[model samples]
Target: MTKINVETLTYTQLAKVFDHAILKPEQTTKDVEQGCKLAIKYDAKSVCVKPCDVKQAADILKGSSVLVGTVISFPHGNSPTTAKVAEALQAVEDGAIELDVVINIGHLKSGLYDECQKELEAIIKTCKAKRSDVIFKIIFENAYLSKDEIVQACKIAEAAGAEFVKTSTGFASSGATYDDIELMRASVSDHIQVKASGGIKSLDQVITFLQKGATRCGSSSTDKILEEFKQKNSA
Candidate 1:
């Protein structure tokens, strides 16, 4: 599909940009099934599920356009590179079409930039070799990083062949912000899309991020956000 202006998008168009999130620790298998149902109802781009729940989501959304996605080394990203890779491959085997793996935050904060870059490259290299069509989105968990750190992280992700550079894991102390989205957009080339996750619950926030160059957003309030967009159109 051709790229259109996210700023001037209609409600239906906006709905397609969301990756409906069901990653909360307390969410159950039934909750994931319900989330997949909602993603299909809203025409969402994908349903973000836990790694273990990939097969379940894939089975539920098999005939729908909504893709199955899962996180690896999530929220903290402290897992070793090999562990992350293994988790990613297992997710693919379980039927995940997209993988959002967190970057090693500790490595970045400790100035092990090379280590950080290598971790990403290792995952990207193997995942691509295994499944070339899989979407590899690298999450930075940016609330803990300075502007410079965020920039370096984006650079590393882009260099390592990430399809998108994400702002937060939504499990952090803070989430996506307008400034962070803009900075991330400016930091990377056009080929590397931006995904704003964590606390993006309002329609205005979603529009603001899209207008600022975010290609997609992660939201738990998927139905509410699209309903808000609908209300905006009718208003």
Candidate 2:
């Protein structure tokens, strides 16, 4: 049987798994600030904003324990490796401590595994060599991949030195599923973490993923999830 020890986790422990969202292009500076405030209030590990708002999010999160994160080749993973590398570097310069980069889904689908692996390796190398402390999560956009493909991608991600292998971009057809999370956990070694993102809206879903071995949850519903968790535990 699967056992969950939610009571053993402090509020901060639950909060640190969140990667708050700031993905919309229309999101203003005020929006980013508000998101940062929510992340801090909930003690989230990071606030994930669009690349343009990385600096603003980082500024708002300053002095707080929250780390700033941003997406690269977001929503779509078709950008060249060089462009993604440049974007990741710029985000780091803008004070981002974590990067969630979308892997080239098309290449993976076409069986260009070498190219896909090389793309991730390039980004990992750049991030580690330039900013050793920064964390890199490779988003496989799992909704588009098969079960075998997911396992293969996890292997590639682990071999390429990515810190995490994540699910969807939330713009895809589907989001994180239990099957996908389990597949990722079973495929990668303990050294690599797993992030279950996309379509997570409730505390139950958050706990479900964490219990299944996901180290992080990416969602815009961070505040709502945390509120539900507190309410449930308090009652």
**Cα-based TM-score, every candidate:** 0.96, 0.96
lDDT, candidate 1, 132-181, per-residue tens: 88998899998899999999999999988899999999988999988999
lDDT measured at residue 58 in model 1 versus the true structure, 0 to 100 = 95
lDDT of 1: 0.90
Best candidate according to lDDT: 1
Model 2: per-residue Cα lDDT over 1-235, one tens digit each: 1465568777888898899988877888898989999898889999999999988887788899999999999988899999998998899899998999998989988999999899889987897788899898989998789998899889888888888999989998899998899989999998899999999998888888988889899999999988988887899
lDDT of each: 0.90, 0.89
Model 2 residue 24 CA deviation in Å:
2.3
Those runs of model 2 whose alpha carbons end farther than 4 Å from true positions after fitting are: none
